[model samples]
Target: MAINSLKRLALLGSVAIGLALPARAQDSGPLLDLLVKKGIVNDQEAEDIRAALVKDFAANTSAGKLNLSPALTEFALSGDMRLREQFETQRTIAVPGTASVANERERVRLRFRLNGDLKLQSGWGAGFSLQTAQNADSANQTLDNIGTNYGIYLARAYVSYQPSLNWFFTGGKFKNPFFTTDLVWDADINPQGFAETHTTFLNGKDTFEVRAGQLVMKDNAEAIAAGAAPTTGVDAWLFDQQLVYTKWFGAENLSDVLFAPGFMFYNASTITSQVSGTNKEQAYNGSTKYLKIVTLPGEVNFANIYGTGTQLKTYWDFTYNTAANDRAHQSVANGGYGLPATTNKGAMSWLVGLGYGYGQGKNKGDYSLKADYRQTGISALDPNITDSDFAFNRLNQKGYKFSGSYNLTDFASLTVTYFITSRLNDSINTKAPALAADPTLSDLNSTNTLQVDLNVKF
Candidate 1:
């Protein structure tokens, strides 16, 4: 009997090791259980054998040999990919001796992103991501260049700490921390700076939160000449703050309202054209220092509408640039676009939207439909950071956007979006022409865009 038990133990050890290489330690449970049931080993002995098997397996597996830092309690990886078909058409109004012209374009684009997160003890974490595009406002890469390999960029790298349940802090280039819409800020922009957030619950269900950020827009160094003193330029910065409130309604808390009001202040010098014999240089458009904006964005959501698993959502966004200066662009001599003062009334923008859906586009058979109308003033928001698909990212525009999305599977979805837009002020030319003879200065007559996308998430 003693000899038989020893042989049984040896066989079990071999089986455990073999299974552990490609499987987890739990995979050896059945063999251990059978040995104990047949009286080849007692429960205590079986337990001891199981522990030994696990230890041996750990020492032999790649994960166990990784020598990961003890500070890292958990790690996770996730990402998504998107394929798109895009169509765009733009009409340029006729100038004095020119005829109106329409330009149409079609293209295929792709985007991919990968993200990694590491969690450590003491409420501290770090994250990083890689994406396919270099543009701050876009992640899509045109499938051109004769099939050349795409470039990948570091999209996000940040460290976060949550000292307590109600407070959080983050530093480095990270995702937008404000509750906002594309009407004022592009969705793809990751601001490089520091953010602080604090939240407090009211009535155990409702909550109020405060978020603030100090972000760097541009860094300027002094210019030195052979015989002249160093001439320094002011660095541009964006200071932002927002107040958010969420309130739940209905007995089951299936309905809710969210309101976030925000303020943005830009601190920088105005851009001016370089003189014929000077070393000074500036952007084509005037300075961002004129942008002091206030925004109000809110939404109301009703879930399980009439008990049918359908939802209804209504949302709106409004912004006003308090520091918009018409004289900034009143004349070409002042580094302006040479537009008449009356045509530069671009200090306000707004949008209203409605949406209905059977599901949140999560599972198969779930679908959603949405429509929105927006009007953007020339100086209401930063034209460089607006939605690229709308009016070709131009300001002084009004338009309607329609979209539909359906989930093909839990991890994949198909979506279609259309935009119909035209210039809000016909007198304000969309292009900032350097010379009066520049034909591109024609007013933007119309713009239409269509996009179809296949997106997969993991």
Candidate 2:
């Protein structure tokens, strides 16, 4: 009986409240009055009017809907693509060069890149980039090959771990720590070896960076021969190391140019010469005091060029970067020659280079111009087939490039460039007459190559 009485009292109270409330609230009357009485909608109505949203919320609340979770955010993706073309011209007289000059050939290449950023609930985040080149990685040549197929160039692939400020480590292919232009390395199209970088600070608004790694080398036997030289090419091991340092030059972006120079140390096996077994090379056979009248006359040091030889090859190079507007060209001049630091009877050579650009000045003209040059260090050139001894000499190289660009539009442009080089004087070949006597064939040396190419990137 008490329970029934309580239920009736509750029903009567609900009925009394319903009767007292305005009937217009249940009808299609002004919704502002209900909000105004509940201290919501203001009189001037400056607040935004979300009609559908308020109606849905009201219906759900009336239906006894209790919200527990928050709404999900959206994931977005972005990418870009580009096309490129290249052409070359080679017109030269007969020269016994390493290979035939590649003729006038035209090719088109394609490139694409994609990026994804996953924003987690925590402040920490992760992302990756998938890139591709026109020359697909193939095991063999094919017909109708446009370029490398569209595949994961994997320019960078890594899971970032960031638990502090200005600190991160991504374990995978990444931008080389070396400071240089993309066109020189086209770092975007190909992935290099492993790399790492660390940044520390000085006073406020100041920081420093350090990077280092190794690259694949040792594909040249010239290096192996160098090491054996008191006798030849500096012998090098299979790989090369890289190191660089960068520091904040000044304060804001206007003064933010970085100064970075790098160095490397190689780990190579020493080379030595062996004089036993089949190597009866008569060249320096214990400095023959009594010359034999027979075949020994033609024997030279390299008669046993096959001997086991061991030696050390080492060098040091330093490069510097300055502000764009700063006058620094002369300091970066090319074509250098010098003797080895070590007294081991061998030689080491080095050179550095820089260039200037004008078409990219403040003028919004339709065309641009740039000039640049680079050089190789001094080294020995193979001349006489019978000269088994290594001679230290200056045989440096040089190259120059001229370029112009025409603006097609905001996102497109036409570029044309001419690259050329002057012939360098190698060691004087005294043995040419002896070898040229053969009426069947002859060998000659000359240097000249020209090229033209087109590039498009975004």
Candidate 3:
């Protein structure tokens, strides 16, 4: 009996050591302590086993070989890749002699992103990310160009300092810190500048938060030439502030509500145009003198309705540009739109959506369906930062969006989305004078878009 017990103890120790090889150094301590307490091994024997495990791990595993600094407490790597097939159709109105035209296009695109995060001592953290494309509103690369290799761009590089549990500060080109929808900002856009955030807990159950951002839009080195004298160029900026409150109710906090009210100020006097990596101008084709906006965004959630493992979600966003100036909408001869100033208020944008889901669509067997209605005015939101897929990123449009997603595995999912939209105002020109031959009119009347995507994450 003694010999058999010794053999079993030896086998158990070996199994434990093998299982702990991929785990962190501190993870083997509990198993070793248990072995010592159960009389399976002496203290010295447990120590010997631990030393052997560490040595073998360092010799075998790539992560174990990493010489991380002592001050670095944690590091993580994560990313996602997506393959997409997109289809689009646009219709043009007929004129006196010209027939109506419909243009259709189809393309396959791919997007890949990789992110690294490092957490240091004293509440400091840094993060960086790489993406496949250079567009601020998109990360997709069309699978063309004679099968040439694509270029990767630096998408996000930011450092954050959290002096306390309730306060945080970040600087550099970073992720959007505000709670918002694609109605006002694109999902892929990372704003460049600084942000401050604060949170207050109420009764340890409800919370209120404040978020502020000062983002640089453009930098001009030389003075801007106006009518007579050159005006000193002021670096254009977008300033944002928001207040969010979240409350929970009902048993086990099954019902939750959240509301965020925000304001934005865009200073774009010196921003004439922006040249992109493709040497194409991206935005600011039109004047952006007045773009102060007020926004209200909110959501409500009910968990485990009727004891089912599903959630019901309703969300909405509303924005109005208080500084939308009629003078900016004057005819092209006046350096504005082709329509009269009084006819183009262009001050409102809003969306309402509903979703039903088992999970957030990130786990195996998880599925979700969502539908929304949206309307955007020409001057209601920043055209350069809105969703690229909806209405081809054009303003003065209203549409219905439908999407569904199902996870095939914990790290893989399939999604399909459709957008059907039309012009909100048929009389005004949606394009800049440089883009349209008829500066006073636009030909495109309606658009339809479809996208199918397969995404994998790690």
- In terms of TM-score, the best-performing candidate is 3
TM-scores for candidates 1 onward, in order: 0.83, 0.44, 0.87
Task: Please report how far candidate 1 places residue 131 from its true position, in Å.
Answer: 0.7
So what's the TM-score on candidate 2? 0.44
Q: How much does candidate 3 score in TM-score?
A: 0.87
Q: lDDT tens digits, residues 132-221, model 3?
A: 988878899999988699999999999999999899999989999999998989899999999999999897589999999999877765
Q: lDDT tens digits, residues 1-458, model 2?
A: 12244543453344334545322223322444454466644433312222323443456544325342232132235554554454444322232443434345454544566766544433344456666633212111122355744445444544434444445444444444455431112233223344445667666656565554443212224433444655322332212123223333332222233444443333332222311211111122111111111100000011112222211111122222112111111111111111123311111222232322223322333455555443322221101111110110112333455566655554455666555543232321112322332110011122333223233334
lDDT of 1 by residue, 1-458 (tens): 23356765686667666675533665778877887899977777777767767776677776655676789988888999999999999877556467668999999999999998888889998998899888777889899988689999998999999999899999988888998988878788788889999999898589899999998776655466668865556666788999999999963325899999999887764333312112112343336677789999999998886556688889999999887664235312244345575655677999999998887677898999999999987668766557767777766779999999999999899999999998787666534444343212123577999999999999
Clashes of each: 0, 23, 0
Q: In terms of TM-score, which candidate is stronger, 1 or 2?
A: 1
**Total residue pair clashes for candidate 3:** 0
lDDT of each: 0.77, 0.32, 0.78
Candidate 2 lDDT at 166 equals: 45
